[model samples]
Target: MKKILIFFLFFAVLGSGCAQHNAESIYDKDEDRAGTDINRENDGVRRGNGNQDNGMTMTDQNPNLLNTDNQNRHSFSMDVQKAKDVISDAGYEPGSIWINGGEMNVTARLQGLVTRKDREDAQKILQNRLSKALPRYDVKVNIE
Candidate 1:
């Protein structure tokens, strides 16, 4: 009876140790994964900054990093086109306008020395036009 009891206790201790080891290994793997993520983030920041030397004008490595060109494609949906017409009618040239059909938000950044009055007028015109064209979406005009 004593031998059997000793054998059971030994097995129980062995099982618990195995469980502890497995838990430690899992914790180590999680730490490794987090470290990798941090390294990747650092690398991205470095890549964005690019290489710079002493006394030289730094050129943009990725000029289109923000994807502005693709986002500002003149060819827009019908709603955005109508909104542009309204701004033009108000005598405010739409320099950079971004429209997301999915988001249903219109963001227009007017480029140039635009007077505050002109901006207000443009906003009024756009609001009217967008209400008529894209009734479901809201338009936000930002002067750049």
Candidate 2:
């Protein structure tokens, strides 16, 4: 009985430690991706014709857009705001837009939430509207 109890306690401690190690590894992986992502965002902002001379780079000004404290909140807010502006200007009424911004990882799942068919249709309208309005951005609308 004594041996069995000791074995169980040891296994429990080992299992817990393994889980903590796994969590730390996941965070480390995200840190790597975040660094790369910030570089790309900064490059895009810099090359936007005259936006680069603002004295600060994109990642320097808005670190949240690159590596977020709360990732879902960060990405969701940015993607939602862009989607709203695009959809609204394309004849969509308020609260009639949904976006499935791409995920950060394989486990992160991509989800496009639309309240109605009208919302989906509005995305199509945005394709035409933004293409004409922001002709320089080369904005391609992919509702998927």
Candidate 3:
């Protein structure tokens, strides 16, 4: 009886995750395209009044658009903050960051006359730190 009660309590807590998720669920349209060309015009046949008694109405957000081929791969991430913290901790500061998909493009600059070796070292450190934190991301570190 004690084992069954514990299992029920665990299940209840796990079920509460849906309510605890605070982030907005936005769909990645680019990642939705899976190589195969889909003609949106011929996606579905709609009857009058937008009511489908025999079928389901198709929107831009189709459940099939999700990556069913590879469940492990995700299109979105929050690695920009990690890269910022990494560079800041290394004593090199980054300007505005522009992120495109999984790629992070950052530019760092130092005032006054600076040696080429100093710039190179800063770039290397940023690349290494970001790569280690986000292995799948393409890090572009530019120092000026």
Error of model 2, residue 66, in angstroms: 12
What's the residue-level lDDT of 80 in candidate 1? 60
Candidate 3 per-residue lDDT, tens place, 23-136, comes to 543342222346432323245443323444445323223533444454444334345666677778777766766777667787776666789998888789888887887787
* Top lDDT prediction, candidate number: 3
Candidate 1 clash pair list? none
Candidates' RMSD to native: 15.0, 18.2, 20.3
Candidate 3, after superposition: displacement of residue 72 in Å? 19
TM-score of each: 0.34, 0.24, 0.44
Q: Which ten residues in a row have the lowest lDDT in candidate 1?
A: 56-65
Instruction: Please provide, for model 1 over 38-138, each residue's C-alpha lDDT reduced to its tens digit, 9 standing for 90 to 100.
Output: 32355465232344554432233333234343444333455566767766765566555565653345455676777989778766766677676656666
Model 2, range 12-74, lDDT digits (tens) per residue?
A: 999998897556553344225445532235446533235555665454566445653432433
- The true-versus-predicted C-alpha distance at residue 112 of model 3, in Å, is 4.4
Better of 1 and 3 by lDDT: 3
